[model samples]
Target: MSQVIGTVLSALGRLGMIGAIMAAFGVGLAGTIYLSLRSPEVEVPDIVSKDRFDGEATLRDSGLNVRIRASRYKADAKPGTILDQSPRAGEVVKVGQTIAVVLSREPKEGEAPAGRDEDADDAANAESSRGGSSDTNKNDNQNRNQRSKNVNRNTVNKNANKNTANQNAGNRNANTNRIANRNANVANRNNNQNTNNRNAVRNIANVNRRAPTPATTPANPAGNRP
Candidate 1:
């Protein structure tokens, strides 16, 4: 009976030792599993519909690095709101991981789009060319008008000079004609006075000669009679 009791005590001691060893092994395995499962990563949060500053802040709070990818125009979407994101929301990523995003903005009224900058530059160049052309045309017109005015003035001055010369020439001709007529009248008066004096002298001489002849004839007749 003593031997059986000793044997039974020995078996109980062995079972207790086994149980303790199993429990220790189980605890070690559980600790390893928990450690292996743990990671230093967080979920990427959704920042859509948030303002640009607010979205970046939220991304930073969610253990992410924020970067702007691009901007887009969405007519129905909110202006200056987060539009899209890389590494979509709820995706597990390492802490301080960069998240690229696209920002959204509505097109303004009468505002040109970003894609139209080159076209706008071309339009501006064309408009400048047109303006330059218009200015050139205006300058040409002004020059022509000024030249026309000058020509007209010159023509008027020439006509005036011509008229003055003709009038002077007519006056000179009239003066010459008057001088010639006065000289002719003076010559004619002198000739008439010389002719009248000659005729009077001849008549007196003839009358005196006739008187002498008659007196001589009467003397001769008286002598003969005596």
Candidate 2:
């Protein structure tokens, strides 16, 4: 039993350093492997000068998450631009770490220059409206002028027709008067001829009545002395 114990102790003493060295090597190898498999840190990109969407995309492409945590008004800066970042520009961070950012806010209501453009648009619309009304009025005036012109032409035509009718009536009256005067002159000539014939017949009858008794007495004495 003493010799067996001695042999066992000697064998253990010889194998212990080898086992320790192997264990140490194995641990070191495992640690190296673990380190190799771990993801490396990345530098945060400078996104302050970039648009928010562009910055966010750039961070995402670099294996980082992005968070828009707040916004501040900046009239000099472009709207929606990255203003500031936490874990600021050129910061080293692990993969999937979030880069918090503040963005510039857009101009608020009643403070935008777009209102001026709208006012210009309104002015343009008003001008167009006025122009349209003027055009309408002009058209109405043109139509009225045309109507007046037509009325004047119609009146002139009617007067011309009336004058033509009056002239024709005057001509007919002149013709009728001439024919009446001619008929009266013909009747007077016929009456004068008839009176002359009657006077001649009356004179012949008076001469016969004055000479009849003396003529009968002279013819009886030439035929018989008694």
Candidate 3:
């Protein structure tokens, strides 16, 4: 009976030791699972949005890195927006992996953009103003060309009139010279005729005076001698 009691005590001690070992193993396994499920904590570096950041340089200056991953087709989002992200916005995550983003493309044909209609109207008005100015300049140039033609014609007419006046003056001077020469010739001829007439008259008078009483004495001498 004493040997049986001692054997039973030894077996009970071994069973207790085994139960303690199993419990320790179970606790270690549970701790490992908890550690695997937990995420490493990291700060949300920065968030970039069009209205909030306003400038590309400003967004880049922040610690967060941006990468365009997708595109949206709106004219207003025309600026673009932050659509989806990994590690989700507020949750902690490892650094250096780029946060994917999206950008907006140019507007479509008929799509209207958000904001003032005045900008579009202003562009149209400016184009119209430029067209009007070009037309005015062309008309002004044409008028200037016509004025130049008129001035040239006037200059030609003035030159022609001057030439004609000079020619008429030369003709008048020639006529005067001919008249003076004819008058001079007539005076010389009249002077020569007057001189000839006077010489002939003087010769006739001298001939009459010099004709002597001819031979009257010859008849008287013949009667006396008989």
Encode model 3's per-residue lDDT on 47-75: one tens digit a residue: 43453234333334544455565554445
Candidate 2: clashing pairs of residues: none
TM-score of 1: 0.38
lDDT of 1: 0.78
lDDT of 1 by residue, 1-226 (tens): 9999999999999999999999999999999777656647899898877898998899889878888766766655677888666666887877777887767767768755545564344334433533444566889999999999999999999999999999999999999999999999998988888888998899999888888544454457556665
What is the Cα-based lDDT of residue 91 in candidate 2? 60
Error of 1 at 113 (Å): 15
Candidate order (lDDT): 2, 1, 3
lDDT of every predicted structure (CA atoms): 0.78, 0.78, 0.61
True-structure lDDT of candidate 2:
0.78
Scored against the true structure, residue 181 in model 1 reaches a CA lDDT of: 93
Off by over 4 Å in 3: 1-132, 202-226
For model 1, name the residue pairs that clash.
none
